[model samples]
Target: MRAPRDKVIITCAVTGNLTTPDQTPYLPITPQQIADSCLGAADAGAAVVHIHVRDPATGRPSMALEYYQEVVERIRAKNPELILNITTGPGGRFVPSADDPKVAAAGTTLMVPEKRVEHVTALKPDICTLDLNTMNSGKEVVINTPGNVRRMAKVIAEAGVKPEIELFDSGDIALMNDLLKDGTLKGPILCSFVMGVRYGFQPAPETVIYARNLLPPDAEFTAIGIGRAAFSSVAQSYLAGGHVRVGLEDGVYISRGKLAASNAEMVTKARRLVEDLGGEIASFAEARRIVGLAPYSATRAA
Candidate 1:
């Protein structure tokens, strides 16, 4: 039961890893307000934005490499082919010393696996997020081991860059199948199964169909849900066949506890639930050829 409009890859996530502006005033800090909310979430129906930067005067969360080279050169200076995904899960969160709970707490937590992805290997962003195994990221306890996801997937596959692999529970999808059988992840393996984050993994429909049956038949995936389970897992990840992520970086309300003014109105309400489930939304160069990405470079990206 996983095959509808065929290619549905939305993936917005314009700014996250921490919501500020006192938890939701449309949280997109500087670098031109995250490149103007990632160019209005890639013209509503985002084909892949997923960035994270902040610190426009203390909004916080910033591992500054010139604010990720000016928000990936202002979203490739206006969609020069925008499939930019950048976030090495912002270092790694690890709060400890609550009455000496084994000391280690200075706010911007753990940054080691090559300084937790040195600004995605110096802005080689066509995709970057190697947070393959680290749990309990609510208010501490996140440790991406497997020797830091095999040293940040071997420097994001020697700077060719592409490691989405962010499975949060069901054992991090067997640590991304042991980083794809230790060849250190390469192939079409892009994953994201972020359920609610209090303890991680809890958005149901059987946890998005057991994280799409622990994908390992040449995996390619996406599914984000938090805060009212993002309208039941973005229509349950398009009824479990995969692909779909939304904005305000994992929802900042759009009902019940309402408050979602923009982030291109959360990808225009996730492209009206993927055209009311008849699904058809993968643009930005067909989501860079359905996420193999390697083409959009408007004049060497400005």
Candidate 2:
């Protein structure tokens, strides 16, 4: 394992496209709620806030540009320093129809590469996710072909937003290397190992370590364990020289059978865990530098 850094970056995934309000009342739905969640997470020691917007009335995931614009504007107005990582992984889902394999089934959101990255280009966030692999995400197939990935990577890079390559399993690492070799992605890459989603890598120390070993030496990575493995993955990633991400997007529960009150609560606990391990939490500016982002300036829009 590589040597652990003295400082760790904590990212809070404020809201996700998957989970709904029914599963947990604490999930942020409206733009105001999402913005507020980001602020709370930042206050709780999270340097970066990963966001996914939802329909305020229906509480369903939305790719509407206005929703994103409003959310980003609100967060920027209140906390300009926090790094925002918007999701470009939402429209890649494809559930093929059993009756007609050529056609998409319900719950499929397959989109053109240009449309998938429209928000990133428009908003110019500090960072935007670039999912490097296509695999089964529960019942639906999350489609990210090599061509699509390259296209999205190019667009994101041209927009001046750092791409956080997201990997669900070890196989995804090969794709990451390909992107690096092709120059679609640059060095000191920021990767996130998302574990324990259905059909994805199971959350375990060995799994986390194996994935970490595949990364480029100069790359910085974070690990997130879904549901029950959330906290354990955080500890393992920290011990193995990686950063951490947590929030309602990954898991709603703070503990077994108990739902987290908010994103802030999860971040607070992450801070304590890092501290208990004798690690210092990285500030927003420090996190930007560590991830190869330019220093934040007040004149810069969030």
Candidate 3:
């Protein structure tokens, strides 16, 4: 088992692809709202903010480059020091048609892997998620085939942005090792165990330990709990030598009954959890150094 970290990195996923305004009225739908939530999370204690934009009018998940550009620009204008980890996870889901299982249904978003990372290529955020799972997510399937993952990785690498491998299960971790071995991905990698997704990795203390053991010795990781496991995973992850993540993207409830007022509120609870466990939250510079990323100014020059 890995030893505990000296400084734990708290990453706040301000908004996600699947969460909707109906789930919580506080969900950040517009670009301005998303940017404001991110800055608030950073101030609350998150070193890194994982972003996903949505349609302003419909509040549906959007892969529009302009939306992403606006969010990144707004975040940079206010807090260049805060790490930006954008999502390239929206366009990989496949919904098979009942009439023809081989054909895609209305919700299918599978597209050229290059199209998925277009914003990452353009904005060149400090980090972007590279989902490595091809699993059954509820009624739909999230497909990140090995070949497509390589294609996406190539675009992310070309952009000079670090890809935080999002591992949904143990198999994804194995695939990550293979990618690292083949040079499809670089070493000292950053990854996260996305627990509590149905049919994927379940959240538990032992689950965290098992996934942690499978990672490369030098790899950095975070164990993120989705839904009810959200806050619990923060303590579990830190005690097991990994970092922590929490936000609206992962879950909405701050306590047993109440919904979180904002993304910053979630981060506040996560910070207290880590501190209660005797872990120190990593600062902006500390997190950059830990993840092997350059400072904001240096990244801008590239």
* TM-score per candidate, chains pooled: 0.31, 0.98, 0.98
Question: What lDDT would each prediction earn against the true structure?
Answer: 0.79, 0.91, 0.94
lDDT, ranked from best to worst: 3, 2, 1
Pitting candidate 1 against candidate 3, the one with the higher lDDT is 3
Give one digit per residue, the lDDT tens place, for model 1 in 73-121.
Answer: 8777667677888888766777887788678876637767887787777
In the range 125-225, model 3's lDDT, one tens digit per residue, is 99999999999999999999999999999999999999999999999999999999999999999999999999999999999999999988999999999
> Looking at candidate 3, what is the lDDT of residue 77?
86
Candidate 1 CA-lDDT value: 0.79
Candidate 2: clashing pairs of residues: none
Q: Is candidate 2 or candidate 3 better by lDDT?
A: 3
Error of 2 at 224 (Å): 0.7
Candidate 1: residue 138 Cα off by (Å): 13
Better of 1 and 3 by TM-score: 3
In angstroms, give how far residue 233 of model 3 lies from its true place.
Answer: 0.0
